[model samples]
Target: MRFVAMCSAPAPLDQAAIRVRHTLMLLALLWDADRARVDLAHELRLSRSATGNIVNELLAAGLVQEVGQREDGSVGRRATLLRLKACAAALLAVDLGASHARMDLLDLRCRTLGTRTVAHDITRGPGATYSLLAGLLEQLLLETRIDRSQIALLGIGVPGPVDHDTGCVVQPPNMPGWDSENIAAELGRLVALPVLVDNDANLGALAESRFGAHAGLSDLIYIKVATGIGAGILLGGQLHRGVRGGAGEIGHISINEQGPVGRSGNPGSLESYAAAQVVPALAAQLRATGLQTRLPDPASLQDLLTHAAHDPLARAVWETTGHHVGVAVSTVLNLFNPQAVVIGGRLALAGEVFLDAVRASAVGRTMHINAARAHIALGTLGAEVGVLGAGAMMVDHLLTPRGLPLLYSIARRAGQPVAEATPLAQDAASRAPPAVSAVYTPHPSPPRSHPYSPRRNT
Candidate 1:
């Protein structure tokens, strides 16, 4: 999966308030039975005074409460425990993919209440996808019984390139008729809630970094090699999204100049060769058409992958695709030199043959430091990752609130506009040590560039 970011005009905020709120939410995610206020202060690297102010604000908002004290097992007063009020608010997460769309309801503790999924060919068109998504959303809303007023925020993850400003599919290959549309805004009118949109691959990466497999790894790559190909990059704990929404468009990297044109047309793009988009049909041809392959007619992605593990023709196809994957991933490894590359998606089911081939080729082509330092491994999150990532996105948007109320879930509650917000510097300083991001080092997010099919290759 790829992690692409869009450039947007900064939202006005009460910087101090946002910081406190954001820090509290992060603490909530990191909180557990061993929770302690001092630990919170230490983990966030905030001064006692600053952490106190934040905790107080959350307490006043009725979002948090002091549960009890932690026994230090030493000759010291017990430290008080703080945690989220389970019923504080609700969130909605949407995952729109090539084959299916789902909506989930989550509480403050990151518990899922209700989920609804629909099986529709989203790639046929965007309008249809929207309608189907709307229906599932309605069902989720009804099933969860969450009032529009109780809904805190909405987070959406979609396949293909995302338009940062509009929050829709910019140039998805499988899904058609989604270009330059503000899907978040359109769905807002139907549900009336605040919404945040991001590419699925990017969300997958963030999910891993925040709560999934790649957690605690500051710099890592999460690659999705299913119906499509993309990568998600996490640097210093924050997701690395490019200026435009196509930063990790690894699938479009042409492997051979003279090969078949890809979905996004860069000739021999990774998806064109690696994705399951063509595998089922190809499997059918080989099995039904009596093309002389050892493997019988394999229908699903699993079937192909299983066959490839032993079938000669399937093995050849997998090896060929692995070469392309290594060619593309080696560049990323060389450039970023992340400590790990976690590969996922339907195609990843092809297993050891694909992984071994890609790894061998990548090791041969890339710097020894890059190859040796970063372990190329399969993700353990599996198929549910997209939905889980979508949930994380929702939690993120809720935690990092801006002053202005967004247009995502229009029928949802109104957050005070960001224009009248204040910064965290207004709070008194604390003596506590800070965490890694306390200084907030900046990475340049590029301009809003679209990933369109260029008239010709460079």
Candidate 2:
């Protein structure tokens, strides 16, 4: 996900301190951990009194609720467990690809309520794309019977390099006319929600880490080999967007300095060799060399895959492409040494032929230590991975101090204000040192026991 700075207000230091504690508490509860009050206090390095104050505010705001008492067979009194109120609010997640878009309405816990996909050309520029997304969102809301006011945030994953903080897209080679466009401002006008924009590949990485077959892999790399190729990287369970958000443009990695030029003016870039769009042409070129094949001259990627089961030429082209991908992945393995590398997007559909080739090439090239630990696998989240990732990012932001205002605004519009101050919180105005530092440095969360299994709407 992208990083957004916490919004500072001209409020009293005590209030700011309380807000920080509240944000940290929410994060501790949201990470699929079954925690009690004392557990939260311990994890956040806060006093029990301060933890109770934050919990009270969250409970009043209807963002969190006590489920039941924990029963760990401890000798002491059973501590009551807390969980984020799943139905407190919902988020709108959008995945914008080079030629299609998918949207999902997700609850606070990232359960999909409604989903929709539509084919559209992203090259039409920001305005047209925004209009189309707005329409799709309207359709999704109507189908789900969700009110506009219930949507707490909008998270969109675009197929481009995004300035995560500004919500602006950089000069993405795949997305023409999207350079320096502030997608959040443009899309916010139509959706009327706080918008978060991030790279689609990064979202893929986030989704895979949280919900794919390789769920719980903190240090992972998700490579999206679609119309364009790029990578999403995670380090210590956190997204590494790098400085200026240009960290994962693997498609521009040059394999042949004198090979064909890509849109980015990079010669023999990985995209030129391994992207889904290039597969058909690669097959055609191989066929021109008098190779026997039943497929037509101008076969689509789908057609090639369908014929690949028995077509030697089709298999050859995929293997070659996979080799190119493996070359780049080898470089990734050496540098990042991630725990796993997940391959997603259209080209991943080639199945074993593609994956096996990638594995062979990558494993053969990288250091044995790095290669041995890294698991090369396919993404199980399918077409909705990007949307899921967008939703996950939104949920994460909503639990933070900066994003709490957006949720609070939604709550106010719904006529739910913060709960009245209690006797325990009467001394909130007291000037005292915070129990913990303002900076939150959370320990890496463990993998969820039950990862999300995506359900498609009938």
Candidate 3:
């Protein structure tokens, strides 16, 4: 009986095991440096054979490549070094702000190969936006000289609250015509690609945490102060999206009940005072007072920052703007006690003057313990943060336990045969590994009105 049982073919690998192996391998490469087969095996605490199987599958999927031999001054044969194939698959990241649309073509390593930004009003609605995006995508491909077939995924960051599960923008105050629009479905139809959407501030937070100067900090807050103010909250290394995905709508948080109302109909909101739009008007008011300063009449946000150091009037305006932002940030610090508060967005370009005022006001108002622990700083990625964040999010999703099958499917489409290319894929259904006993069930995306069909020009 024992011999018969031992000789019987094993069951197929369950969803859990496939995901575990794929995620472990991808994440191990993502963080580690100059990995070899032996290094991964030790890192994952898996047997050499199991690790090799996972590495082989990754290689077949074109997600990783054997770079060169590791030089550890070994006695005999040196192990081949393995690294993520940055050019294995292309990803497009779009950052749609209230007044600008920015697109970046990134490789699997999240390195930007080409980037373009165009001025466009979001209030024009989704149809116009999609058309513009399609043109931009074509232009990006042409500029980078990359074939569209190599593209794997598209990620978008919008200036609004997003229902991530459905990729819909929900009642965003800045985006007048985009309320409740299914961004992913509409945009996916235009480009014929798998699309993921998230709030711009959320992406900024993710970018700062993963790729900024303070990379790897688990708990951080990314505050975006632009045409509108918002925050992305990361607690314990995960996004703390509220029940309705409105957790970081800090712009609407009321500082004074009697203050003037803004777009969101929130009285005394942070956005009402400190948004980038307010800077121009505020500067106008100061100039009207005949305050002798180098600032131009009706100064732009850029002008304000340019003269902030030398001009007294510019300093006053920034001080005021930063104070408003800082007051709101103080509340966040006290409530969340994050490790760092990273300021980003268009207005953050003001640099030290803006950051100093924010730090002063926030630290002054925050509770002693919270103030002591939280370090407020400017973001390092600049205007590219949103797109980078979106790319990072997509990468993370594709490596999740539920995402391995989709990744494998994408790899298969890119020319690798799942059954023949991967070691266990051939007889996985009948030769399940001993550790993979759980049942596997795939949850496909809901059928779309406009199903994905590559829209590439031959």
- Which candidate comes out best when scored by lDDT? 2
Better of 2 and 3 by TM-score: 3
Tens digits of per-residue lDDT, candidate 3, 383-444, equal 77888788776665555445555656665574742121122112212111111011111122
* Per-prediction tally of clashes: 31, 0, 2
After TM-score superposition, what is the CA distance of residue 145 in candidate 1 from its true location, in Å?
3.6
Worst 10 residues of 2 by lDDT: 431-440
Model 3, runs deviating above 4 Å: 1-23, 288-290, 412-458
- For residue 330, model 3's alpha carbon misses the true position, in angstroms, by 0.6
Cα-based lDDT for every prediction: 0.62, 0.74, 0.73
Off by over 4 Å in 2: 1-15, 34-49, 69-80, 416-458
Candidate 3 vs. true structure, TM-score: 0.85
lDDT of 1 by residue, 114-167 (tens): 777777777567567667767776786676556656666777777778765445
Prediction 3 global C-alpha lDDT? 0.73
lDDT of 1 at 88: 53
Q: After the best TM-score superposition of candidate 1, give how far the Cα of residue 204 lies from its true spot, in angstroms.
A: 1.3
Q: What is the C-alpha RMSD of each candidate to the true structure, in Å?
A: 9.7, 9.0, 10.5
